[model samples]
Target: TLADAIFRHLDHGAAAGPSLAGRHALVTAGPTHEPIDPVRYLANRSSGRQGYAIAAALAARGARVTLVSGPVDLPPPPGIDVRRVETATQMLAACRAALPCDIAVCTAAVADWHVANPTDRKMKKAPGATAPVLTLAPNPDILAHLAAAGPARPALVVGFAAETHDLERYAAAKRVAKGCDWIVANDVRPETGIMGGAENEIVLISADGSERWPRLTKEAVAQRLAQRIAEYFSPDRSPA
Candidate 1:
């Protein structure tokens, strides 16, 4: 498949050299499932394609990649460690457990809130009764926590901002707010075909400025990001 071929190319260093050798990378992907009831939950349209591609790209570049993923239908990529998770809390814990990494990329669309008191039994509908109200509580901020991890923080921390408008403006602010080194901002509006589609058009926002990338397949985006990450850690390479 295209994904396999992309990884092979990177593995061989046909484009750029394997600059990530001897490094460790952590990636989070997919959408967290916030259960509303025993049989119902809230989730987004994340397909985990981009995050999976990134994990593959890093692994191909000889990085020891640990992917912490939420519930998704995609198969695990070869040559990397995978930790499956369900809710935002689990994802946060999984990410922290994979810490002391050189790089961290959080691509999971985590739910901001979860049912405060979810019951194990199935919630039944009562005849002539009104719907039940759910008490929501905010989930932990995984990206921020990692970024603020002090000495244990990764050298480079990347976060994703899936927005529908003000892409550049909002992403720039997110970079500062989250204390991440970079923000991969993309339009997730249905028409953009980015939420669950293969291709993506993104703006790479860093401390310096934002660079608009051309529309490309998720694999291409991953490869490009991996190369940039390699350059960031390359000796004699200046800070961006």
Candidate 2:
């Protein structure tokens, strides 16, 4: 009850202004785990720091933020609604339920494929019986689904591209393929220390072109991105 009251006070504009007071934002964060069995699962290295920061930033701008998050250790940001999920399918469903929002940002590193036939019980070695095979199935593409043309489609949909090679080309192509308004591209190679790290270096690709941003704290990036979204929704700008 104390947490709820605190969040309510923060949501009531205690620290945030009213620039984006009426807007609603939907964000997906963390790494979705695809189950192999009761004891085994597949996941990525995402820490969910960036997405959580983004949610906090948007909330600070006065937008109602609904964060559909995957399994992570981070605490929920104040003045935001956080819905936790474990798989990509669940994440998509949660995102759909929070739709008709003004902004959607897909920052979760969702698995591209999941075990099609997960065992009900824990898998065992059993003295090495030729190693059990795992049939992989394609997971639902949440970003593209949100970017699809429809009445519930958000005005701005942003996706993240964590690439190890050909970052710009791949990110741009992904933007086109996903039909999202923007793609935040980043190098996630282990050497870059960007993945699962506290700082980030990103190149924002949109219809307007790419803008390379300096390496900064994840919170800083979130603030800049939130400011950009606020600018896009400013009263003076003509609707796209």
Candidate 3:
């Protein structure tokens, strides 16, 4: 009920102000599960709260949003299309399929590596037996792929960087490496409580510069980001 109320209030505010009507947005969220076997997988602590909030905010502003999410406990936001996924590969495929969108926000905590040869059957354990070794392979760089999508690339591509140290340095490097328009950087160290917590302290990095944002609820962050997106598309506004 609290989330519903928040969404309603934000939606009402967005509807009364700048709108993203006739625009399409693609958002990716949650932690991808890299399977090692039929019953076991690797994942992170992402709760998908921020990504879902962003999707809702964009939808509230009248953008047609397609949310490609990994496993998350939260429900899908209202009035937006949702595509559920598991592995990083699947998430990338789903994102590619939602192409030609005007905006792209990738917030998924996609695993950097996946099991090179996953087994279909559940792995079994035996007493006095050596544990099975897993070989890892690099996962696709979804943000980079989308950024280099040529004619199909979204006009505004945003990516998230969850780091435990050197937030600004790593995020700025990522922006160049991924070729995305912007990078939303946040410290996700355990004490920060951002990995699975409601509040976020972030730095919005772009070609112009970085803006430090105060700690706020994920919903508030989403609303602010949505407003920025709307401004970017506004005819009177200059590109940042």
Candidate 4:
């Protein structure tokens, strides 16, 4: 990026994490936009605060960050390269283009389906129009794709579960099916208000077991998650 080029004359570089130095990290953010017409799109209530915070935390910990993001109104974090995309397919392409990263954080609330054939022209309602039918197709699961990247897979692939209920059980099932190294599960029920809120609570599920964390600020969540990632990759890291 032109902004990153400003520090071209840098030496070894001053960074926060020594262990994660020289590692490449990829993070996807926001909801996928499945277009129904030229003007309308399908998406979710994701402010991208959580994903952005995670990316910033990882970058601060010395990893080269590539944020593959969907359309959102938030500002990109500093010292990180941003790849803007609208749909899940575009986001997947961006991730593929920047493959073999050391870590991948699948944080984007990607849509599971898209309009099978979206009209290029603006869809109009006739004078007595009732409703328009849209055929839907499944969007590629970005997390599953990254986890099964085969040769170019990241060392650590983490997936997120935004379920309305049975968070742990559902997340575990997704973890096994998606092939991710870890799964961060959260309950997004109406009462949780975690969809587009400032605070979050989650449980990290891995091969060893599950670790529960209390509700905290988004920044605090990022910091704690980053620390867990650091420890997991540490030479002497151990399961808690």
Best by lDDT: 3
- The superposed Cα distance between candidate 2 and the true structure at residue 67, in angstroms, equals 0.3
Per-residue lDDT tens digits for candidate 3, residues 1-240, read 999999987757465557899999999999999998888999888999999999999998889999999999999887889999999999999998998899999999999999999999888899989988889999999999999858998999999999999999999999999999999999998998888998999999999999999999999999989889988998876555
Task: In candidate 2, list every pair of residues with a backbone clash.
Answer: none
Question: Candidate 3's C-alpha lDDT?
Answer: 0.92
lDDT-based ranking? 3, 2, 1, 4
lDDT of 1 by residue, 1-240 (tens): 999998886556434653788899999999999987779997877999999999988887779999999998999998789999999999999998997899999999989899998888899999999989889999999999999958999999999999988888889999999999999999998888788898999999898888999999999999999989988998866554
Q: Candidate 2: what lDDT?
A: 0.91
Off by over 4 Å in 1: 1-15, 238-240
Worst-scoring 10-residue span by lDDT in model 3: 9-18
lDDT of 2 by residue, 149-196 (tens): 999999999999999999999999999999999999999999998888
Q: Would you estimate the TM-scores of all the predictions?
A: 0.93, 0.91, 0.93, 0.91
Which stretches in model 2 have alpha-carbon errors above 4 Å? 1-18, 238-240
Question: Which lDDT value does model 3 have at 86?
Answer: 98
* True-vs-predicted CA distance for residue 178, candidate 3, Å: 0.2
